[model samples]
Target: MLTSKQRSILRSMGNELEPILIVGKGGITANTIEQLDQALSARELVKGRVLPHTEWDTRETASELAEATGADVVQVIGRNILFYRPPETGRSPRIDLSGEG
Candidate 1:
């Protein structure tokens, strides 16, 4: 779980990242989850979106994806959602959460 400060830092980091994943008309399919898992594993901070055709709204999509991925929902703005997962054990190049209280 992220505190306000941690979430803020991640949000700013997310500002520069492009939406790596897009939940389209298919909604949250297994493929979507798989791609998201891959992206989050490669990059600790990931951004994604739900297209207008999807049945789920912004929060539901974000929350559902976060639950499935075991990643923290940093923020959801408009259609975009930011997710963060600490790198697995022995992994380097993860988000540095140490400095923020």
Candidate 2:
């Protein structure tokens, strides 16, 4: 779970990011979940896009992907969605959600 400030910080970081994942006509799949997991692991903050051909809209796609990846949905605007997940126990979190109340 993320506080509003944390989500806000992530959204700002996401503003400069290009969509790393694309949810196309295939919609959400095992492959999509795998890719999202990898992306979230590599980058604490990840942005994805939902194409017009997809059966799900941005919000649904974001919700599904976030649930699948165990990540927080930072924002969903237009066709783009942002996700955030802290690194695992031993690893340092790439994006520091600390220090900000």
Candidate 3:
């Protein structure tokens, strides 16, 4: 879980970041989840964009991705979803500004 302040901070930082991954007509898949896992390992926070043509609902996709990637849902705005996971070894702590914590 993330605190509101942390989520707010991440959201602000996320604003400048472009979506690194795009969900298309194929929708979320095992391969997609693997890629997302890799991405989360490298970057604690990642933004994913759901293509307009995607058949999956935004919330559903977000939930699936978050579950697969072991990440927390920071925010979902329009077709974009924000995901966060703290780094291993406790090197970098995930900051959540949503105040969910």
TM-score of each: 0.92, 0.93, 0.87
Q: Give per-residue CA lDDT, model 2, range 30-83, as digits (tens).
A: 999999999999998999999886578899889989998999999999999999
Q: What's the CA error at residue 17 for candidate 3, in Å? A: 0.5
lDDT (Cα, 0-100) at 11 in candidate 1: 91
Candidate 3, superposed: residue stretches over 4 Å from native: 90-101
Q: What is the C-alpha RMSD of each candidate to the true structure, in Å?
A: 1.8, 1.7, 3.5
Which prediction has more favorable lDDT, 1 or 3?
1
For residue 19, give model 3's deviation from the true position in Å.
Answer: 0.4
Give each model's clash number.
0, 0, 11
Model 2 Cα shift for residue 66 (angstroms): 0.8
Q: How accurate is candidate 2 locally (lDDT)?
A: 0.90
> What value does the lDDT take at residue 54 in candidate 3?
61
- Per-residue alpha-carbon lDDT of candidate 1 for residues 1-101, written as tens digits (9 for 90 to 100): 78887888899899999998998887898999999899999999999988886677989998999999999999999999999988888889568766544
